[model samples]
Target: MSQKKPSKCKKKQTDEISLSKKRNTRAGNMGIGYETAADFAKRGANVIIACRNKDRAEAACEKIKKETHNQDIHYKLVDLSSFASVRKLAEEINQTEDHLDILVNNAGVYNVGNQLTEDGQQLLIQTNHYSPFLLTNLLLDLMKKSKSRIVNVSSLAGMAAKMDLEKLNKYNNFFTDYALSKLCNIMFTIELASRLKGTSVTTYSVHPGTVKTEIIRDSGLVAIVSRSIIRTLFKNATEGAQTSIYCAVENDLEPFSGEHFEDCHMVERYKSAQDVWIAKSVWAKSENVVQLR
Candidate 1:
């Protein structure tokens, strides 16, 4: 006699329940940020989904909640382009959580035409570099308290950057602004790691393999021409998030503070990025910027 097959309804319910635990296990460009949060939540982490849009953040939280069956997932509004918003969010996090386990400096902007922040810094530089620097500093005490890990998502584009104190604003070149911002990320990660040595906190910077995302859409002509090629050539967002997730959760990484990573392995940074003088100068400049607040 043939055995009875499981009911389709039962199969569907099981699938949904499994997904509710860990959704989107595969690589995809758009949902990786949420996927990373979901994975962390499944591992019993309480995550804060920081984003510029309240609606989008809430929607992302809901999706993670439904997918992971984890109510600890929540959202916070933060516009990295604005220092005030970053401070506000940091204050709120400090007040609410006794500890922050992981701080991922993942949100970034690029290819946007010349734009400036209220502080008069270039928008990409402000968002990608300065604001994260400021926010991390403000939250350092809490991170130290929790012995949290800090991960900065830098870029391969940073290799092309040349530290130009005079042209940091890149008044004539938007691409330089973007590249320099990423370089700043790496430098900040290294310096912070050095400062936090012997402490529970550690810092790392990663070059997330090129992934097709909305960042390119900001560049009209180039985006139109490159979209298809990028889609075909680049890893999806989940793949991009891999090193970030690895850095956030892996035990082996804690001892290797200040290291730069790509595809889950340590790699040397650009010569300029590794310059002690450049790092010191950038750190001083960053301190001044945050002190103004």
Candidate 2:
């Protein structure tokens, strides 16, 4: 057998091929998250990109407009890590749009070392749970009018969590903190669904799967790991975004509100996530924390 050495052009082409594949597979772009936004915009749905970074959100909106040829995509500034910012974003959305057809709670933070928000709550809990909770509540009326769908970008981590209602502001372990917040997300989704039972609006929680996004880089520890190593462990953002997209546009899912999803399929969540007592307590505490009651 003859031994062959890879050519430089072949290697370059292979790298680009892999890069393109990874980009196409990320959950942020692949699944219903961004792609659905593009589709909705193309179909004349006025889509808004709620994000903390105005520059990035505008760039994304521009790309969507250019690619989808839909100029209606807009951006709203929101910092999910801060309750005040979330409120401002919700107010802006409410003031501008008469009806919001879809609200995708896709913004998230992850795996960072101990950090706190402006309100003094743990950052992950505030960003991944409280902010979204408050925003959804603030915009509930608009959603009701539009018969909107709220898709919460939850995580598999929630299943591994147990909530301690008394200590929402404290977490003995970092990963546990993330997991618990995700659990809170699921509980909130179910409770919101119950509240909207007789209304036109619906809510759902989804696990976007392990995705390779800037979030991992944002984590001080994980950022040290070689890129190649992390790439082997996770799908790109689009693959992680699959469930959100499915829940957003799939007609079959319209009747499946308040459910938990993974990889575009509805699945039962952790039993604790469905406990009415826990849900109520969390809801009360959440409202108090956000001052939304």
Candidate 3:
């Protein structure tokens, strides 16, 4: 693929929120991911919603098709905790789609416990960071076929995370693991942008603010007991999806490719996210973890 001139994304532009039949936008998860996909579908994009559950994916597709009055939405199954599953999803997309215009790595977990995936990695890390990293790498060729934007849904929790390259695959407490995974998402975006510099792909990390979603359903009693308060304080799925949707469809974002965004605007990246050395080191470690050749 030939490289396209990087847009002078110095000044952020308003949201376009439209996609043609030639552009394909894929988002993961069900909550904000669903909202993001629906918004794209409303604008006439070919949308694919990827997730682990067959029932949920099917239902989400059906609902989105009805709500958007756009029948182009579809679903595919993907277990983010498994490398095999991630690869399979990527393979299927690459084989079936002519080109990919946007990829939203929106699915993630929190406080999922100390268990490991079949891939022998911490469940949280695998689901939140490693699998997305591998999937992006696997789909790069297809994405490069068109001008593409890669959005990894990160979190504000990443601001509190301290980078420890060795602890990436090791599980500590739930909170610690979750923070680390989010930090890794930012690092992954930074490194991926550097690697894809002259290419047609631009990547970003986004914080969808605190949203009312099942992401916290595994946080045990505190989450259960605080559900009402959480709902009262957090943004709804559509509101929370603004930044991810912004990064995906907004124009002139190529110059800020590796930057972090929140509230639909580019904000200062966390101190840790600015560490290029650490970002490179994290990428190397992640490649080994995912066995990316």
Candidate 4:
């Protein structure tokens, strides 16, 4: 979540912030996402946080309402591992909500094993890249109704990723798969912004810094040591959430759409992420995977 700063843009009383979450998301609870949602609520924006867990979602909503004094805060159910769940949530939102002003594809997994979701896609890739791609596309129509910003929470790990489209679903190693997923997030933002050109919608990919959160699910001695080191040295949830919140509310960001952001400011895109051809190919592959014909 963001700092409790009021939005610089003109506000409609009905302006809504719709963000995606999941049960195993590292950013859930008092993580970066919760802070991002809380900041928005403090601004009096109608916020809908979609998560897979019912109990946690309700508890989060109630806590945000109490803390921000914004009764407009609500939650919806969604499991990023399943396209059906994503589609269901999207359909519900499109039917019930008038417009979506901001969308943060914030939830992701780290080093989950080489498993596959029910949709038959690789579990890590589906949760980190494919589901969010599908969710963002599904919500584009409603977002188009108003000036909107879509924030894909990418990672610095993306910079190290070497794109291999054929192996996107075939995991090589824990770090490689996670890096590829993050790289896809940036590429998706680029392709999405190109497609949304001339419209009122803009998109950004953000590296929320090395945050200490539950998304780190690696194992073994090295993994444990790395987690401990990360917890000791990296930014906390509040610091990690700043860029996401900035992307959501920054008024002058339209001109920088499709760019990468860090430290709450626009930054250079990774060399691989800037490749238009690869980005387009990733988009095509994602469309086929999500069956968004």
Candidate 5:
């Protein structure tokens, strides 16, 4: 007997179903994290909102679910300031999820004064840089399995910051530390994209604009005054989340892999952010900081 041929329409439907099984994760609770999660949920994707506080995480998850009418949302506790906590969170995620379709490193801290994580790394650097690096490395296998996309929420501040790799951990000023951390984000994206060259996992860094987020929450009167003044010019968290969402789900970004994006458009970045030598140095030092090697 002659064998029946496969239907092209059936194959197309199967492909669509597999592509739509996108599992998304974002760090941070309020601000762009909440909005990003909601945006993904609205598109029929399962999301994981990883935050430092479980209660807030749960609340954000509920709020996102309610707003999007998508029930596939979950929350997990992750404290980027502590290496142990980051490891625990990554371990738990890897154990339960067979694949991680999208990861957005959206959480960041901008603090004044001298503060350090348990790893003896600067608080700003650890939260904004090292922790994300470690988490990405740990989840790389899962991301690879899913042929995923990684969106890192960086900033235009990175364009102006000058990084001194020698004294990177000796940070006290908020602006410099914040900018440096973001620069690191772009550099890491560049390096990771190179490393995953043959793999399906691709990475992109985003400049979410000068959005009104909780980054300055703990910075005293200065934080309040800045927020009030910038409130007039800067976009809100939902508006700021646009570029991140664009990078995460844009279907035709093959020619722009490892690029920095702003306002949902891919553009050239700063000289420092584009330096290959600097990117490699940051990658190697970050490995030592996180003991990845």
Candidate 6:
């Protein structure tokens, strides 16, 4: 279950007055996204939680705000599966926020079936990768207003995946599509960083371990067993959020832009993740599909 609005965080730390400004941020409000927002909120960042469910997102926002004592936390309805919804949220943020300091593409899905979105994109790929792909591009202008950081939440499932648009549609199975989506996130980070170089913006991808979240709650027996195992064998959202928080705020990491991080440190990734050609291809295809300018 998504954490109940946490009790006022007994562990919440305070910052100097100078550090207490309303920083613009937008992230998913589930799993590591919740902890990630709490971390930012504890530090006085203005956080916007985006998700498909407005009521849940709002409840999450309230809980986070109370716990972190950061009333600036709010929720916006966003359906990642729909390009229109993603674009609308991006446009709203860009117009309303003078500067976006942190953008965490941390929301994802893990369903056990194959289906297409109303937009006709594969479900998992659209939700996990393409939605963020399009959302990030639309928000780039506002992010540029600050020395900003964008964190794309990825996973180990992507280890060996490559972007072959011709074969992309053929990957209709559950695990394969999810894996490819994660890989696409990594490549998006790589290519987006290259594109944003010297522009005071940086992007990074994070492999939050098999977190015990509702991500797999609906995928049937395997997911139930996997969730149980994840609870036993892997990190919770708080622990999983660590690396994402590190990448978004660690001052020293400015040097490692575009890198993949795990356990709060940068590490070597699947060599296939370094395929610039694949990254470019993914970027081009994403642009075309999203019809970016």
Candidate 3 per-residue C-alpha lDDT over 130-180 given as tens digits, one digit per residue, 9 for 90 to 100? 999999999999999889999999999999899998787787888888999
- Clash totals, every prediction: 3, 12, 0, 4, 0, 0
lDDT score, residue 30, model 5? 90
Weakest ten-residue segment in model 2 by summed lDDT = 18-27
Best by lDDT: 3
Worst 10 residues of 1 by lDDT: 20-29
Weakest 10 consecutive residues of candidate 4 by summed lDDT: 18-27
TM-score winner: 3
- Model 1 lDDT per residue over 1-293, tens place: 13232121211111122221221111111355765676676665677888887777777778777877878777778888788898998899889877776888887887777887888887878888888898888888887775578889899988998887777665656678788888999989888988898888898998878887677765477678778888889877667677777767665467678878887767767776979778878888988876744
Model 6 stretches astray by more than 4 angstroms = 1-21
* lDDT for each residue of candidate 6 in 22-84, tens digit (9 for 90 to 100): 577777677888888888888888888888887788888989978988788988889988999
For the record, the alpha-carbon RMSD of candidate 3 to the native fold, in angstroms, is 4.1
Residue 287 in model 6: shift from native, Å? Answer: 0.8
Per-residue lDDT value at 79 in model 3: 91
For candidate 1, give the lDDT of residue 86.
86
Q: Residue 235 of candidate 2: its Cα lDDT?
A: 60
TM-score of each: 0.87, 0.83, 0.92, 0.89, 0.91, 0.91
Candidate 1 to truth, TM: 0.87
lDDT per residue for candidate 4 within 57-158, as digits (tens), equals 889989989998988888888999999999998999899887888898999888778898899989999999999999999999998988888999999999
Which parts of model 3 have CA positions greater than 4 angstroms off?
A: 1-16
